[model samples]
Structures are given as C-alpha cells and as structure tokens.
Target: MDQQGNDGWILVETLGDAPTVIAEGTRQRQCRPLGNVYRGRTLALVAGTIASVQASRQPARVLLGETVNGIGLVVARPVLGPGGDVLAVQVFTAPADRSPPAPHRAAGWEWNLSASAGPRRTRWTQEFRKLYGVSDTRPPHAYFGLADLYRRVPRISDIAVLMERVDNARPGESLSGELIARRDDGTLRLVRFVRRAVDTPEGVTLRGVDHDITDRTDAGELAVRIMDSDVAATVHSVAGVHAALVDSYHGYAIKWITAPLPGLSAEVEGGQVSLLHGDDLGAVRPHEPARLPGVARVSMADGSWAPHAVRAFPVPGYGSTPVVMVTFSAARPEQHSQHVGRGRCAVPDCQLA
Candidate 1:
C-alpha cells in the first residue's frame, strides 16, 4: 500500500498483514485519530471531512474537531507533503464551557460639591435638578453655584450675616432660610434651604436641601419695606430733627435722631452728622460728653438729657451748630468711637455770646 499522503510518518512493512507504527513525533501524540476510512469512499466525502485536512499542492487549510475521552477538542490545519498529500496534523484544545466573571456593581449616588479660590458656577446632580424643577435635558453647567444663589437674594448683607452664623455653628447644627433664585426658564423661585457646613478635600462645602418658598419670602420682604417707610415718615414728622434707621444688636431696627433746632441751624447740623458711628454703642458708652463751645444740655423726647461735650464749629456764612446732631459710633466692636472734640461758634459776626 502507498503511504505517500502521511509525510511525517515513515512506514516500514514487516512480514505482517497490519502496518506497524514507529517513531511518531510529539505532534501525533497530542492528536487523536480520525475514524477509519474505506478505500471506496468518494472524493467529495474525503474533501468534506473535518479532520484538519491540507494539500501541499493547493495551499488550502481546514479545521477539525475530535472527542478525547468524551471531551470535545479542536485542531488547526495539518501539514502536507510535496504533492497534494496530507502529512501530520496539529491541534489545540480548550474548555468551551468556562466564561469570565461579571464586573463589580457601584454603590449609592456619586455627587460632590467643591470650593474654588474664585467664584464660578458648577454642574448640579440629578437630585438637585429635580428639586429645583429643572429639566434633565439641560446641561449640568447651567446650574448656579452658592455665590450666584446669594446674588439672587435681595439683601446681600443679610446673606453675609447668615454665613457668619453658619461658620460658628457647632457640629450637626444647621440653619434653614429662604433665598431667591432664577430658574433656567426665566422664572424666579424663593428656595428655602437647610444648610450645614461639611469639611471636604476641596475646602468647606455646604450641602443642603432646597424647597420653594417664593410666596412666603416675597410677603416677608414687602412687610419689611412697608415698616421701614412708616418709620422714616414718623422720624421726619418731628420738627427740626433728622433721623436715620440703624440695625439693633438683635438685627432689629432702631432710629437714631439728631438734636432739634431751628431751620438754618438744623440744616447745618445735618451736614456735620456722620452717617456711621465709629463706636459700638452696644459695647460701651462714650466716656466724655461731646458739646459745642457754648452749647448746653438738651433734653430728649423720653425726658432724658445727655450733655454734648464736643460740638460742631460754625462756618463763616453758615449758622451755628444745630442744638442736636445724630451720629453713629466710629469705633468697631472691639474699639469705640467716642466724643473727641467740641464745636464752637467762634465767628466774630455771631450773635450768641
């Protein structure tokens, strides 16, 4: 029989009916045999066989699968001899049942607020957008930062004061207040916020929940303006007196009044009165009285009198210092602005001695 198709094997016929197998290399040891074929099989049957057949003359490749001890195995194309003949087959086996593990699952929401050295607007979380009644279709960058939120509120001073209080609060302490903000739709909303300071890698961060408080905040502000206008009118009614409203220690309102005097005198007095006091009346009272050179003690509306030790100086053409001049303390909370100097009517043309 011709064994020309199996080039890798050297066949030696001994005096026996069956062919003897000899020094087959490692390639044959790894591969299992395909089923036995009869000589009368058609050429088409041999061509369609899956046993990794290859032909040296045609440079064609084929893949084959076999079962070793009932386990399915796969192999690559076999080597072929010079003339369209198969030589030795090479195969590789892998487990087809095993697969890789699935990826890890993520935990709860991943939202964070950061502080930068300068002011800026940043992205908002999905929760924030929902709370503010914002559209999810809008980009996150459209959301405003805390600074922008503060600007939306009417009184900036009130926000500053609130921020100071927030800084001093103890752990777990939070403050709730109403603020106004403009939504992307050009509508305004007064949002009530419960805020607490949280120290984070990006500096102090304020995390809070916001609820719409537009109606309440608007009503409150209107009531405040009405009250202020009423007080101002009452202050103006007092004859020969000028007054200004000031914030009390408890953040309430108080009117500071000037001494009553005649028309020209009052006008002169108003000009000299300082808008803000240098002293903190809440802390300490003025040590010495401030009076003009010749002015005497004047009684207040409450039937009490404080002597004026430092008084305003009379100008050449203008009248003498008004009877009373309302002034604020120039001193800070730590230091007081006290009555320093007295005013005098030293003009040679003045009538009063």
Candidate 2:
C-alpha cells in the first residue's frame, strides 16, 4: 500500500523473511519512502503489525493513518508454509471509499394531524420499532401519540421542534433532517429522515422514514481530521517518527512518524500493540519525562540502520490511538559515536514482543 494506503493500493507482492525486522527502500513517491516489505513510514505501526502477524500468523486489519473526509485502511493476510509458519504477508489497502455504503432501510412513520381532538396520533412501521430496539407487542394497525414517539428517540433533544414540524406541515409538502436516536440497549445511532405530507380518509398525515447513517458519519469525521493539513498530516509528513501512545509502559497506539504520524492508530479488534522497546519506553512517561538522548539504529531510506538521537514528549490527541507524543532526532556526534557498533538489541526502529 503506497502512503500506507493514503494513496490507495498500489503494488502487491509475496516474499519470505525471518522473525527479525529489517527495512530497505531505494525510492520515494507520494511523500513517502517505498520498501519492498513495508512502505508504512511509521515504525511503530509497521513494526507492530508485522510483529503481530508473525506471532499469531493471522490476517489483521488496521487504519492507514488519516485521509481527507475519508478513511484509509489495510488488511494484511499472512502467507503460511505447509508447516503453518508465516512466510510472508500480503496487504490490501483502501485509500479512499471505493464501494457504495451498505443500505439500511429507513424506518417508516405516519402522523395524522387532522384530529381536532385531545391529541394527534401517529403510526409507525415495524422497521422503526426494530431500529430503536423496541419490541412491538401491538397490532399492526395500532396508533401511537406524540408523547410515545418522543420517548422512543430520547436522544432527539429537539422533540418539541419535531412535533411542531409535523403540526405545521402542509399537504404535498416534504422535509428532511438528521436526528440522533438511542436504542433500548443504550446504543446511539445517527439517523437521516425524510417526511412527506398527504391527505387521507382519517386526515392529513405525514409519512416519514428514518435511515441509519451512524457508521458513515463516524468514518467521514475521522477521515476529515486525518486529511486536515493542520491536524494529523504534520505527523505523517514530517521527518523521523511521530507516534501516539496511551501512557508509559504501553505499546504504540500508532507511530509511523516516519512519514510523520502513527499509521496504525486504529488498531485491531482485540487490543493495541506497544512499541518493541523496553526501558526506553518507560523514559517517555509524562510524570518524570527524560530523554536518553542516545543513538538508536533507525531504518534508513535505503533499507539500512543509521544512528539517530531519540527525543520524546507527551501531547494531547484523539481517536482509538492514545494521548502522549514522541519524536525522533539525529544523534549528536558524541552520542552517535557511543553507539557506532551496537548489536540488534540496540536497534530502536520499533521491535515488538
């Protein structure tokens, strides 16, 4: 996935490798370095994902950083040998929404305003009942008043406005709006509604439908922030790794920072994976922040290790990824000289457990 799926799926390949993490890339495109095994610039994200697949040997899905009013994600499936060992990984990416959203039938409702009597009556479809997790025990022809309707969609704070809309609506007129609905289980959903007015034997009635748009709305909001130039783009586009962390002693919440931000901020279903470093991570704690200011072996643009000084600090953020921040810097001459000939243990390109 190019730009870690920020640019959508590009080239796909299959290869073999050891448990040891190594990076090599000789070219650049779309604001990122391209490596045969991994193009995800965020070390924490790439390192975490690869290490996860290598351990579980199962396919994993992860967010591909941020996008403009859209979402990016990649599904990495492990290629296994006959003996059941992971040989390589194949990743499929979605940089933009390429598929139509799944459909959800809008729940239907009917309001009869002709009743000059005590209260107007409204009839609702089974779809509406089920949408709010309401158990319908009444006959199909039953009628419910405005009070009952308000109780069902408690999250619609503007209940009075809704009733007024129906009351003032004229025959042959139509209206549309968005509302927040809450189910019996305490789950909240975003619903888009449409209403049309027509005359009937009973009286002028308003026909309405409520369709669920929660998933689409949520994804769109996330995409906008990610693609926003001032928000997540800086982390992804800047030099060195910019990672998000939950707290000290935890794994990377998402830290590609290579292109500049954590690409795997939205982790897999089970839990988040921490960066592979040990005590160094502890040093990043907010309460007693400290910088080792030592040299670490980073994965170079040409797929090699280069000495760099590590600088980290905490900052506020949003989404599934945690708060706290970390940035990497080039090592000073003395610090670089001190770690000139260290072994694999000294490498800090994010090694996962």
Candidate 3:
C-alpha cells in the first residue's frame, strides 16, 4: 500500500505453511501471475530460480523477461513464519541488460574418421595418444594399416580366426576379439579390439577401440592349460565326411583340417576348412596308425564306421583361445592265427589266438 501503489506491489503470505496470495496492493505488479507458479512447486523448485531461495535470505541475479515491461534483475527471498520456517517467497524484478552466455566445452577425447578408398584420414584427440601410448614425436597414422598392424603382432598366426572375422564383417556390424601383440618395447601383450561400422553419406566409417587384456587373458589361458594338461585324454574337433587333413605336426594327428560342416568354416582359409570337390582326387587323408592314445570310433567317407583313438594337447602361440593338439590312430582287434585265421575278440581280451 503506497501513495501511487505502483512501487508497493503485491503482498503474499502462507496459510498452514502453504503459499497463498494474501494481498495485492497494485495492478502494476508483474510478479503476480507467478502466484500460481508456487501452487504446484515447493522449495525444490529453487533450482528454477536465478539463485537458491532460503528461509531468511534473498538471492539476486539477472533474469531475462519475455515482455518489454518485465525485463530486469530479479531478487527472490523466502518469507519465513514466526517459527523461522519458509512459508512463502517474495519476488521483485528490476531493469537490467541481457546478454547470451558463452559456449561450454566437454571433457574427454572424441574422434571422427572419413570412410574412403586407401588409407582413411582419422582425427585423433589428445586422449587417443595417451590411450595407445602413441609417442608425441611419432605420428599416429603409422599404426593405421591393418596388415602393418599384423607385423607388430607376435602371435598373428594364432589369431587368424579372429582376424578373418574382422575382415569379413559387414558395415554397421560390430565384432570384438582378443589377440597377443607386440608393443613398441617389443613386449608381447594381449589386447582386445572392438570395431563398429557406421554408414555415412560419403561412405562407411569404421570405428574401433583397443584395450589391454593381458591380465584377463593370461589368467584365463593359465586355467585352461592347467585343466587341459590335467586330463590324460581329450577329443579335439573330429574329422568327418568331406574332411581333409591339411597339416600335421609331430605328436599331433593334424594341426589343421578342412571339414564341410556348414557355417563352421567361413572366410577362414588354409587348414581351417577347405572343399575337396575339384580334380584333387589323389588326396589321401593321412592316417597315423601307431600313435593311438585312446580308442574311439569315427565315421569314414564311405559311410562305414571304424574304431579310432586320439590324443589331444594344447598348442600355444595361436590366439587367446587355445589350439588343441590332436593325434589319430587306427584301432585293431585280436585275431585267431592258426584255426580260424581271423577272429574278432568280443570281451575275452585274446592276443593272436
């Protein structure tokens, strides 16, 4: 209640701790319509204010108004009751200038690479260098080539399966695999790589991340090797119809075998899986007769089954996953030498009877 009533403005109070308009001294008050603003709002709504409103204090800041008559520096304070508790908020707006705030920069590294023929240009952030231990003096592009990357990998031959998967992946598809690689110090470490393809107007972009998994792979491989060695006998992936022994090593039947199981072999070359359908007829599947460790029956190409035995061991330097050592031998039964000439031993364990 003032002389002109223009400056006195509106007076608000609380009823039972709830804010309510108790008095409106002037129609010129611009903070009135906001009376309803507190209806559904509590002290939690302080975040919407220029500064936090307190029980006995007012926080002042420049608040830009939508209308010409409503522009100003707004000051709002919580009106406390006789019990020193917040009962209502009294808002006052004054004249002030308006200016836009500055832009904010986020923390961390971000990169974008163009998908194109030949070596694609990549934008690497400072964090990228720190992540891969890229030397400040050496350029990052030196490590971009996938084949060149293979040269740095000590166990590239072992991760052939994983590498084939990476190479055969389609756009937008994601693949993750781990392999042992040599760092700049010539130390071999297991690293996990993840890649994703993003289709763009220009072309497809390949995004990737590499992480060190030496601790994890070492622990896992140690456990597998311990368990594998503890087993006196084991059966590796068996040879089936349309299977060909690609490569054999000492103490193992075949290091690599190409089988015709659908989906089992894709993009994997060499002894992983090969087709024997062409004019390569004289290809005889080599059989190691004297190396049998245990007895098991396997199917032959002629549809007939024959007894065979195998012994498997782990082959290191392959990949994060252990390669099995497999050895196959033909099984023979005791026969009658003099009378029957040949007789199958049922259960009587006879030797040349």
Candidate 4:
C-alpha cells in the first residue's frame, strides 16, 4: 500500500478497494495528518481514509503544514458546496512569509472647535469672532481659514502677544506697559494697555483697557512732589513740633502738634524771626488753632496744643487707612519757601514775607 512521489507518497483507502490518487503534489512527507486514523494502517489506507472523510464530511479546508525546509504555516477557509453546504475541502501548503496590505492615507483636514455648552450648533468660526471682537459681517469660514486677523491687521500680532501673556498671568496679576502700534485706522499711538485674564468655560479670555498715560505720568509726578513738600513744611512750622515726611501709599499726609523749643528758637531769635505760624497754618488748620483729625488728642510736642494738619487724599489705592506716624519736627524756611513756589501754600498768611 506504499507509493513514492517527490518528497513522499501514500496509498488511498484499503489500497485494494479505494480509488486511485487524484491530486498529488511535491513535499507530501512534510504534510501532517490532521484527523483521527485507524491503528496499524498502511500509508495507502491512511490517505484513502483522509480523502473519504474530506469528501463525505465536507469539512472546510484547514491546511496544517510546513515548507520543505520545515518553516511552519497554516491556511484555513470555508469550503462551499453547490448549495453553499461545503461538501469537501481544498488546502495548499506554503512558507509563513507573506506581504501585508498597503498602509492607509488620511481622509481630510478637520478643525475641531466644538462647543461643549450652550448651543451645540454654533460654529467655531462664529465663536472665534465673538471671542476676539471680530465682526460677524465678515465671512466666518474665510476668516479662520486664512487667519485673517494676522493677515488683514498687522497690529493683531501685538494683540495676540499681549493676550498670550494675559492668559498665562495669575488672578489679580496685570500687565501695565507702553506699546506703540498702528491702529486699524493706520494712525500710530503710544498706548498703555493693561490686560487681565479670566478663566471661562469657553477658554481663557483677556479683558484689557488701553489708556493714553503720557500726560498723566508727568502731572502725577509733579503733584506727588508738591503734596509731599507742602505737607512736610506745615508739620515743621509749629514751634516745639518735630516733623518728618515719608511716602505713604504713594501719596503724602502731615502729622504735627505744638511743642516748646525754648533755647532752639532763642539761638536764632534775633538773627531773624521767621514767623513760622500764620495764614499758612490757617490753611492746613482752618480753625483758629489747627488740629489734625484721628490723631492723639494729647499734645506730645506742647501742652498748649494738639497735633493737627489738613486732611489729605487717601493714598491712591489705599483707601482711608492712616499712615503710621513716622515722627514730627520743624521744617526749614528754605524748604517751606520751595513748597510755596510749587503752589502748595496759596494762603497769603502762610506765604513767607
């Protein structure tokens, strides 16, 4: 019941009773038997049984084999009958090496500006406009698609940078600085812009205010010096009073009281008596005897009078909080004269003759 073909061979069925081999190929010995077989059977009987089983049972082809070099491989698929019943099987043997399918290409470009709340139908283009002050009359699709802000207005670059800085800033943090830029109207301006970022569901939105601070800067400096010198002098004029000036919350205020300077004033008494008290004192203390509000009633400088001076503007941004008493003393006549020229003391009596 034995026969020889390329790598090996086999007899069919009982050899004496089974049909002859119909399909034969090279490397038959490498083909492994997959189904059950009777014990002590000849190779020819084994082949015949396998053929009958495959034909009658109609099992789908399940190739289990290896290359002549012994590299393993398996290939399986359903066998179909005339009515798609899968009457029998057909199998092929090959090496395991096989090429894979081609790689996939991208479908198309997509812009994901989807909103999570409010209207679901809102387009990203429209949202971009509302977020950045862009007008709706302009085309939406074309605007974002072409980055129109960057293209149509060159100054938008500065805006973008400022907004980015704001977005990164923390709460209560602000950016105050001068930026020179050409406006949409094509005119250039030195603008002081302050930006603050707010976190919102839509994203980080920057709220900014632009101001022309050129004139304000100059005026503010002058006002500050005038206020400091005048307040310091008023505190100095009171005899026996010691005075000192210090910056408080970026503005100025005065603290003074009457005190006895017996020997000090006498040393220069006849030298030249500069009337330290008069209309200038009246201006600060409009009352016959000036006294400061909210100061201690006790006259630390003099038993005859309490410390007093005019009320001052609250330190900018500091509200009504009173500054700490840095100390008090007499102001030099030259200093008082300088303040008078600065327009701090307009009262005729406070004016030095």
Candidate 5:
C-alpha cells in the first residue's frame, strides 16, 4: 500500500547486483535520483525494509525511514524470487508528522480548568478523582478551593516564576515540571505534572494530566548514589554507553569534565550520551548491542585507541535498556575475557578470542 493506501499506487523497484532501478512509478516529487547504485545515505532505511519482510515472512510495518531528502514513514513489502529469497522491496511513503498523539486514558487524572487563572471551575475524570483521593459525591469546589489547591503544592516557593511559565505556554504545547505535594492523607509525594494549553469557548483553557513518579525518581536517585565511588563512575545506557557521569563519593551530579582519564571523557558530557567521533555523526542506523561486558576501544583525542572494561547493569526506569557503567582505569588487571573483536585490541600481541 502506498502512503495513502493501495489506491495511491507503487513507487520504485530495483533488482540485485549491478543493481539498477528496474522500475519507477509515479510520485516522482521526492523519488530517488536516477541510476542504480546503492547510496550510503538511504542504505539504512533500505536495509530495514528488507530485514522487516524477511523476519516476519510477511509484510512488516516500520514507522520511519531515512530518505534522501529526510526521514519518512513507509510501508514496505518484499517481492520474492522463485527460491523464496527477497528479490526487491516495494516501498510506499506514509504521512509524516500528521498523526495525532495517542490519547491518554490508562492511568493518571485529567482536568480542564480556566486557562487565565487558577481554575475558576474545573471538571475531572473519575480516574483523576480516584488518583488524588477526591470525593466524587461532593461538588468539585467543595472538595478543594483554588487557594487550598495552591497550598497542596509544596515546591512552588516562587509562585510568580511558575505562573509566568504557565501563562506563556503556547497552545497544544505541554509545559511539564516536577513538584512535591501533600495529599489529603498528609503524606508528601512527588508527582509529575503535564499541563497543555488549549483554546476553548471561554478563552484559552488548560488541560492537565498528573502521573505519580515518586517510585521512579526515588529508585533513580538511589542507583546513582550507590555507583558514585569509582574515579569516573557513570550511569550508562544499556549499550554500555554513558548516560551520566557522577561524583560517586559525594552522591552529586557532575556537569563538566574538562579533564577526564584520556579517551572516556570524549564519549560523555554533562550526563548525556553522544558519539565520540564528531565526523561520523550525521545519520543514525538502528542497532542492537551484545549484553555481555567486553573490552571497548575508545578513540582518544589524539586518535589512539584505549581499551575499557565496559559493563552494563539493569536499573528500573532506564527504559528497556539497562544502565551501563564503564571504566578505563589501568590499575585493574585486564582480563582476556573482556577482549572483543569489533575494535583494535589494546593488549600487547593479543588477538581477541
């Protein structure tokens, strides 16, 4: 099916080696440039298309593809040869950035309040009332007044600053931040608040959702503190890539690492992960890494390779990917088991097993 469905027609077709564009269809608006050689820029998307079909033995859906012009979502199906090998792929582009966000209904509470002020009158979903322990039998205002509501939020010390941000929020854009609140039970809890500005009949109104994030926040902080002892300890993405660098002993976050042990610093900055080599940063290809700890070759500022004993540990709220922490300290003896084959081996006259 094309972006508009099967009624829209096909796009392009090509065959194996000395591979030439055997057929081209309509919708030449952003079609591939003529000629048949595989271009590196679009290689990842094409590979994904073929892989999807081969894996399922049927049509598979992929959200987005990296095209010559930019990224696009497309439906890809394979054209099989007599031997059942994939001969070619037929790709149909889909609408980009046109889909509405999936509605939130499973958890949390929703509220529609007057946009200009603390809600003059507000409506709440049943889920909302249950979440904050609001009484459904009583009138909304009787349960909580605007002033009482403000008192519930313990972190709004600077009311003016927060109000400024809320007032300046653009329509449909979510303004999110964290706050500590004392619920009806008198227990302090951390919550994540998401407020979106919506234009309604009365004027601009604020549509909000609140999700309890106390558990996730507490777990993350505890994990960060526990790993803060290594000289350059960090919380890493599941791929054994650093997500954050920490002052482990002090249980504090470190922002700048102007000087770090040689090669490792180049790969991380400000508790965020990025590729070490700047020149190779243009496009991203889908990848899955091995879960086991191994020796990773990190290219230094001067282009020399340094081996690090990279390890990953699963931590909650880091998504499906585990929190990986790595070390380049030479004080610990290198283990032959850590040798990996992908990069140059740092051990003298040692070949990866």
Candidate 6:
C-alpha cells in the first residue's frame, strides 16, 4: 500500500498529459505509475485502449500484457462532465481468462425533445454497422428520420415509442428495451438498445448502445419487456384497444397490454394473460397485416366467452410462426380509436362511460 493507504489506482484525465494516482493499493509498488508497470508492446496496447475508451465514452474490456496476480484484463469506464464530454477514465484490473462478450456497438443522435418526431442528426461507430449487419463499405448517413429508423428496427416498428419514453423521462433518468432488427442479409437478430437523454452544452442529446441479445433473452422474459415498454401506454393513448404479443406456437403468449379479464385465463403472467379459446397451435404465417378472418372468442375472467375483434400484424423473420402483435377491441379498428365500445369491457358488467 502507498504511504497514504489509498487503493492503487489512477484517473487518467482526458486533457491531462499523464494519469494521476487517485488511489494507491498493493499495486502501488508494481504499477509504478504505469511507466514501469507497462513496457514495450504492452505499453502501446494500453495507450490505444485508453484512447478508445475516451473516444467512445463507453466502457471497455481489454487484455493487458504485463502480469500482476495473473490479472490480464483491464476494464475502463469513462466519467463524463455535464457537457457530455469525457472527464476521466477509471481503470481497474480483471481476470483475462473469461471470453469477451459479443462486440458492443455504440451510436447516438441529436434530437429535439420538443420535436421528437423530427429528423435527428446521427452517427455511429464502425462496430455499430456490424450490429445491424449494415455493409461496412457504405457509409452511414449523418441523419435519419423516424420512418427510416423504424424501417431498420423490425421489432420496435414504433421507434416513436422509444422517443416518447425519452421525451417524458425526468432529468437524469435512463431507459432501456429490446428490439429486433433484420440485417441487410435478412438475418434476424435481437438487439437491446439502452438509451438515456443527457444534458449537453448545446442542448439535450440522446445516447445509447446497441448489442446483440438474441442468445440472451427467452420468450417469457421478452414478453415481460412489453410491460416495461411504452408500447401499451402508447396504444392506450391512441386507441383504447389493448395490445399483446402472441407466439401462437407452444401455446405461449405474452399479453403486453394492461386490461382486466372477464374470466380466468389458461395461463396468467406479465401484463395480461393468455386464454386461447381455439386451436392456433400452428405457427402464424407471414401475411399482410389484416383483420383476422373471424372474431376471437377469448375466455373471460368469469366463465363466459366474449367474441372480441382482433387485428394481427405478423412480425418479420420469425418465419412460419413469428410473434405477432395483436390488438383487441370490442369495436372495429377505425371505429374504436376514439373510444372503447360501450358495454363491451373485458370485465363483465363493467359498463363504459
């Protein structure tokens, strides 16, 4: 330990010439201000890693050459100032044996909180293209509109859902959610976008990171995400109709919209429960979004059956049996956008105003 007894660590200021010791630990003896600690090739690698951590303003996990406790990995996360500029990077040591995670892609865009539906000036790291499987050869345009982002984002067709959430966020609060994207090759990949609006010198900027999560999430968990999402709230605001995600296969359904049930469901979980009254065991085919052929007879919280109107929009890439987003309403699609049908509440005898 250093004479001051601080843990051996340093905060390399982005504007400073060298890292200053913020804490001194046992490594105080070996680290030797990194001059003696890192030598030859390792020094060059450490330098580049530091520069990368600064440029991305994202956390980095990198392997270091020189040995101390056999610690091979150096993980660094940057601390930013109020203007969204990097202040310093906190570097710590970790075991290098563990395999690295899927490549993380970072990108962000400047938006007007007052005008979220407007165009956004955007940029992305080269890795960002890899996440969307965008060909590296073509340069990403500097700006994209809501429609453009929506087309690229398959799962969250309503990129507006994300903007709405961020627009309503309180200061310093961050948000996250899952999205499905089909790369140019038509390969469907699940990506999770974690974003937050931070105050910058010019104005507020929306920043986020996108990473592959296809292998990380399960059906049940993905269903729960809808509850966490603003989709239901958005739908509720626009039309009184309820929304849900139905696998239609494996008899699994994630009812994402929030509403009451007239009768008990075959299964109950998350925002809503599943009560498939008929055979829909087969995968839903990729078809044009249209009103389902027949009224859906759903089991109510009570023992009675209610024939509700449903509109299914089959999501792409889940071939044969993709998870379809269905909207339920007592009135027809265009008819119910203004108000829920009178006396047709999901709950029996619950009269509507």
Q: Candidate 2 on 1-353: residue-level lDDT in tens?
A: 23432323221112212232111111112212234335444434555666677789897777655752334655555544323444344344445355322234335567776745324556666666777776646666566544345444432123434544655677877655666555666466666655567666767766654556565456455333323222332532443333332233443333232232222222210013233244455445545434333433433334334444554444332222223444444646344334332222211342211
- State each model's C-alpha RMSD to the native: 34.6, 28.1, 24.8, 36.9, 24.8, 16.4
What TM-score does each of the candidates earn?
0.26, 0.33, 0.28, 0.19, 0.29, 0.39
Candidate 3 deviation (Cα RMSD): 24.8
Q: What is candidate 2's local distance difference test score? A: 0.44
Cα deviation in Å at residue 151, candidate 3?
A: 3.0
Residue 195 shift from truth in candidate 2, angstroms = 0.5
Q: Compared with the true structure, what per-residue lDDT tens digits does model 6 show for residues 235-280?
A: 4647666655555543234334434333444233221234445443
> Can you write out model 4's per-residue Cα lDDT over 1-353, one digit (the tens) per residue?
12133212221111112222212222122112333211232333334434655456442222234343322232322222112222122332234564222211101111211224211111223323332334436444331221222221223224334434532455434444544433334333344433334344554333333333223235444334334334544554533343321123211222122222233232111111211233233323322232222122112223233333332111111113222222232344334333223232222333222
Number of clashes in every candidate structure?
A: 24, 17, 3, 15, 2, 13
Tell me how far the alpha carbon of residue 340 in candidate 3 is from the true structure, in angstroms, after superposition.
54
lDDT of each: 0.31, 0.44, 0.34, 0.29, 0.37, 0.47
Q: Residue 310: error of model 5 in Å? A: 64
What is the RMSD, in Å, between candidate 4 and the native fold over all Cα?
36.9
Between the candidate structures 4 and 6, which one is better when assessed by TM-score? Answer: 6
Question: Which is better, 3 or 6, measured by lDDT?
Answer: 6
Positional deviation of residue 264's Cα in model 5 after best superposition, in angstroms: 62
- Where's the lowest-lDDT run of ten residues in candidate 2? 21-30
TM-score of 3: 0.28
**Order of quality (TM-score):** 6, 2, 5, 3, 1, 4
Quick one: best lDDT, which candidate?
A: 6
Clash-forming residue pairs, model 3: 158-318, 253-326, 253-327
Error of 6 at 213 (Å): 1.9
